[model samples]
Target chain A: MTVYSNCHVITFNYRQSGIMERIYLDNNATTIVDPAVRDTMEPFYCHMYGNPNSLHLFGIEVRPYLHQAMEQLYSGIGASDADDIIINSCATEGNNTVILGFYFNLLKDTRKKHIITTQLEHPCVRESCRFLERHGVKVTYLAPDRDGLITAKMVKDAITDQTALVSVMWANNETGIILPIEEISKVCKEQGVYLHSDAVQAIGKVKVDLQKVRVDFLTFSAHKFHGPKGVGGLYIRDGLNLPPLLHGGEQMGGHRAGTVNVAGTVAMGKAIELANASLDFENREVRRLRDKLEDALLKNADVLVVGKRELRTPNTLYVSIRGVEGESMIWDLNQNGIAASTGSACASESLEASPILTAIGADRELAHTGVRFSLSRFTTEKEIDITIEVANKAIERLRQLSTSY
Target chain B: MAKSDLIGGELWEQYSQRVADRMNNPRNFGELTESDAQKLGGRLVIADEGAESCGDTVRLFWIVDEKTNIIKKATFKSFGCGTAIAATDMMAEMCIGRTVDEAAKITNLEVEHALRDQEDVAAVPPQKMHCSVMAYEVIKRATSIYRNVDISTLAETDIVCECARVSLQTIEDAIRINDLKTVQEITDYTKAGAFCKSCIQPGGHEKRDIYIVDILARVRAEIERERNPHRTLSAEFAKLSVIKQFKAIESVLDEHIRPVLARDGGGIELEDIQPGENGIINVHIRYQGSCKGCAGNVAGTLSFVEQTLQKNLSENIRGVVV
Candidate 1:
């Protein structure tokens, strides 16, 4: 059949559809800035550009936006009060602040120089705990089981009377496995040790109620949802005192200093609002697309899905194809205008295998070949179909080309 | 629409068009089979190189004519990032039609420059520069195999950061280009100090002759000397008599090395100094007490004393146990 009627048809089709069509499946890395959030933040760049720290009208006008953002975050995350939210940079910085803040406060008490965390935490928390270890603070990194789930009993067994704080991630970035935060929190509470949960990957993907979880602190970034980057927040329990992480002018009640990022805060508020509104659709439609993509890819004998037996984020599907290299598969997918990521950072010049995958007892070969496809509410059934087809073809080509196979 | 803003604005923009082109269509991918290798007189050389920090590995194959020493074909199979693939592909392509000796001269810079679509632009980002170095190493390895020499003997350049694959020359270049004044900036630009960080200073997971800190200080001093050429104190010190150098070395050892060695009931004595070939000062030493039979005396304490003397006294000092 004559697929191309003329040169104009070819040019138009290529311009309008072929190269223009992009299938993004790496939402765990970062999400696209939402149009609604961008619209909400647009006016702040010039028209509403004012320092919230200033006392003049320009600053006074922007203060309300920051307050609104705080309120939105507190309500969205199910915090007890808006005053407990400390807005800062990305989730990494938020995690660092809370971790270091806890450590700094406990420094005076030599008896409490120990911290407990999981091995599958995002690199930020893991690195923070390592830094503490380097500075003479004892740390225990609890590795997850085969399903990428860290048990509450593991935390309880690891915690000693000397433990000062316990930090665990609500959801893992690579495997999408959800840890038992409530159970871990209860154990921490019985032991009288502070508990913090890095909810960066869980805030929008799953429901997080501070009332139910009873975590002493929670950390998340806005960009994990549809908000802009450079904005994250930390939730501290009311009546708990944390030393200021950032020292300067009095800001956030002397907890963190530096002028507030007004537009980013506003966009974060709008994004969280939109995320909460669409939570049902995300758990249903997005989950459906993710499941369909995983099921279709599993038709191949080589394909193995990660965290299948554990609770995971609705939009994330981590899979490893035997004998096919994840880096090569991602490059091939990119050639076909698709976006994805490997679970392991090894292929990208950092020689370490995916600690998360390895922690879950995946062999080196399987860990190296793991690919993570994190979906969003914006993902469509058509995109899922295209992703399945493209990914299968790419995996087949890579497996054939792989010399080790 | 989403092409430009995949990861973010500037981070994704750091990659050039050549990187994308080569990643999608690698020039000389895949290894030659046994029969295919027989076409070039059965002198096919295969070598593998791996980056420790990121488990990326590259395997290179070369078909060399033994009589002519000319490489007829070059191919590679890389399990790594796009930069590694592109760099290895370009490296293999650059090797073909050239003599094995000539191919051995290919540096990571040359591989990167060849992959550049335009002049004076980096083919990859700063962090990905190690990929090019990995390609350069595999070429040396293949050449070593062809020449029937040990790969370590074939390596002429000193590599400081094994994890980042950063050579001494690359580290100096980064310092000079970016005017990197601190170890952090050097790590940011060249990633040398980012991994095991043994290259950061004396105490780390690994050890190197020239740490990133030393390279930074040397480059900065060279810049200062270049700005003011009349400075002659260091040069005069270098030209001092061997006896005078020995005196300085004795003082350094007595002050820094002996006290630490004394803690372990060990001491080091300077026996003689002879000016060896190529301006290398061969200083002979005899270990006393428990140090004479200690394993660390030869392995660890020897380097510690030598490095201490070199840092405090002269760069030409080379300590040898008698």
Candidate 2:
């Protein structure tokens, strides 16, 4: 249901396919699969499909592909070891499992079940904390740097012996500010408390080295790297006894259960392989296009790109188009066959102030009015130009609409 | 839209919610007329706590319940959001279950003390502790009415802005909830507006009804009419003063006296006519849609009008019964 009057909540069905435009800028939400990755997973979807947990040859045949996907995901992020990767349906599930699983262990042990997390963490992490708080767990919300960055010292101060784990996003989903995960992971490491990082936005866009950062857990969405949606991998440091988030049949070696989605695994693996292989090309080209978009918006609209400029992902721009409610501008662009996101889409219904924006000390109006434009490997210069043109119009029009209100 | 829609619309929603809440569960609305309340103050307590101390500066509203028993719901209607609303809503809620005697001694300090640790509960913020002051006052006013005592300045203080509810909590909550930056936005959301008119009984504002003394006026007129007999002129005295009074008033000669007078083809004038010289001011006036210069107007109206004026004004300046 479209819980509010303002939304397109319907799932993509064949009904909309004919009318749907090809250039969708809401890649940060999800993206089209890479052609190379699609070809790689074609066999699994039709012929080689099998439950990897099965003992039969057909099942065994898919296991290698799943393992290969995990390795690519691990290697792509420069993981020191492959066994740390735990495959899951999506980054949200991975984030929940890490946070909840850690809490369960703490609750079970009768240890101090406190968690320290940044206000900038996603709803997957933030809501999980809220849920856990209702369950009698204490949480200390770490503040961000003025530009919405969190330094290692904030993590150091926030953590206590009672702190079961610390979660900080590797890069902000909306702004793409690369947080000081390395320094924060160091703090958590020294404190002997576990650290979980939501690396879904960070992994493919930037360099992440479990080899360097040493977070206890990390989550990545395969779709973020042109993989199939609903297939992600979570990295758990070896020998941390985490409680499983879900249970049923003996699958994922009993860590996670129920039959595996074989096609998802295959496509995820293929997408990761291609993404890893084309890393520099995708990275440089998308960044070039993003710069073009960002520069044009800045030069033309005089907008402030939220978060620090130097330490951000090249494929995304969180522009504060002043004098416009971000959601209205997003809708305006949407009507023009362009796609973008307000800082608070998907969360529009709660109508709650964004904790992230508030944490960053964003001006309340500006926080609510922030818009993000994320680019992917398929994003072209022409696409950037179109977005700028559409954005300028949307911003101007939305500004007018805002005045009437 | 209908008047009901205006009262219930977005314009009035916030105030109505606040008023309803105070009416139902004023934060410090219930009475505390405990035998133990003797320690609170030297009285049978039946209003807000902290009410015994004068100048507590609380803001509260009183509404006569369907019971016709006064319901005092208190809040710092002056205190400004959720805390203000919460205290008002909560007090109103709790007050419903209590008695007039219990509502007094409802103190802000007690409500504040109740809310101090309930950051998790739906209590107003700490900064808005004073709103309980108003909630406290509502209880006292309701108590006074219950006892039939007159309340003046003690009850309705100058409401800062009827629409905004800008008391400490409303302002603070507005500043905090939507993170509103300016006073204007706070006004918009909290509705510290005056646009939505509240037509309270004309009797209530000055604390007296104009209609109540109307009967006494009629009675005094009757006494004067009895006191003075044979008061005014033989119709030959077409007094200019009486004619001027009628002219100054709507031409009853037109509405009530005009037609008959027009038929007479002679008219009255208003020069130096003494009212008592015209007994009860009983000029028998008659009328048509158009005006009348009635010849009998001097006899028609002089006495009854004089008596009516003398009776209503009560001899502000006594005059002849003419």
Candidate 3:
């Protein structure tokens, strides 16, 4: 299958047919951009080609649209100032700049190289911590609450003068458990620690009020919120010293230098706006689908649903079908037209347990068998019914194959 | 799977359909439970030793309804991967309400050839086969977490799903209770019949799979193991028979896999490689500081060491360290 990326969102034209043909359910891995978001990106590719960083009328005229996009995003997430939003490649780079840069800057004043994070932070964060640890820097990985929630208390207890930063996620990707960011930010404030939250999964799913929560930094990708894959934004508090991850040019306030992903940034802004606009209504709708799918799998198939019961991103549902291989089940479902994920899209090819799954203490089998089906507002009832029918057949078949005993 | 001798067309068609009848009609899916298992449980599958005694007399599926903390729905189908016909036939007949979480811990290893235990009532498959059995066990543990909802309600709603098992609750539960960290454990729970079973070794499987250059690499492992037959195969070694002959290579390797590497400007530090159902071994070699990023590290060190050991050891080891 060929997947085309426009304005960063990957939209696919699937042409398989069958009652057995598959339907994709793993949107948590990525998403198809809203049609309207795509339309907004069209004009920029063909018409608005002037560089915002260039001189003369052409550059000056294009600059406001870019700033408008920035402003639209800030307003959407409840950030008070647009200046603090630094657009960059996805959250990975943002996470790297904030986390690594914070450490580099901290090293200037104190050799106290320490980072405290949740065990479930995204790989960008987890790996950075691992890399730093290799350099003799200390990092304390805070564990999440049972059911995968990261508690402020966990963060509070892990801090010391040695800690350069506290990094956590606003919502978990695998289980969709929303963390108590406001409370955790408050704790960080009280303790005088800088806090960085990888809000990638939580961006469009939950409301993030940078001003209200008062975190030192917030990192997220646009595609997760319906933007593009490579486009994302980072929220750094005003007057914060953020050294550039790339050093060249005056782009992104010198914090991140490179030719701006013009169409991508604009599209991401639109995606964020769309998400904020439809969040509440879509929440109830997709969550209804989530609950329905979860209930059906539980009732008919030997399946289990994962994620926080009440406080989680509305679309994600993680379940395991007992006595079946996830890979076989995935292949079987795909043969019939169901597209879903065993774990994060970034790491789907791997059979390893998602770090988030491990953080909440899921065992190896469950972690391996985990199938994440995330619903979007456009998902239909017929698709769900088909999923149930297909799931019932495929799960039973695969389970039969695994019955070695 | 037997060659059909019933040449009368109509009669054969009728017989085939008759057999398919047993597998028809939404057989052996599952549900959660309500009562807290006296000793911790959710849903289950309990298969009694058929004419054969496979250790799995029972496979339990479990999940808690977050709302009630009660097991939601619990059900089981007798597991028999091989006796596809007889196993399912017996499973449908035998399993119903056993709730020991361990009962569901059966793996594909135990199911080898389905009716392996049609006679022996208490025979456990090899300890190594447990990972296969444990794959289902992991799924059973994962399935137990679905007590949070009711199925009838979902069909009427709009949740579009795509996973064959579209549910991870049971697997998540297993992880929570078992404290499993690696993909091996999760894969075992799901019984995904590892495409490559090298990950779940007793030691570390940080890399996915290693690639040995040629038959020489295979020979080198034999030579290395033949050299040190006493070097313990990981606890998860699935087949001990072929693994048994590695002493010649083991001694050679302890005497060699590294000496050859050290001979170059580089050095080799051996990391544990797990042996799976197939005789494939997974290994890692660490190069000393200056030689770290050298391009031929894999070929020069890994290949040379592997080739020497396998070639010198004769039939001591199977596939490359990968």
DockQ of 3: 0.04
Ranked by lDDT from best down, the candidates are 1, 3, 2
Per-residue lDDT of model 1, residues A25-144, tens digit only: 999999999999999898899898988888999999888888887788888988886338888898888888978887788844578888889899888898988887888889899988
Per-candidate interface C-alpha RMSD?
11.8, 17.6, 18.1
lDDT of 3 at A14: 24
lDDT of 1 at B74: 88
User: How accurate locally is residue B43 in candidate 1, as Cα lDDT from 0 to 100?
Assistant: 79
TM-score of 3: 0.58
* Native-referenced Cα lDDT, model 3: 0.59
Best by TM-score: 1
TM-score of chain A of each: 0.93, 0.90, 0.91
Best by DockQ: 1
Can you write out model 2's per-residue Cα lDDT over B94-126, one digit (the tens) per residue? 555455556554654454445432233223222
- For model 3, the stretches where C-alpha displacement exceeds 4 angstroms are A1-22, A344-350, A362-364, B1-203, B206-322
Fnat computed for model 2: 0.00
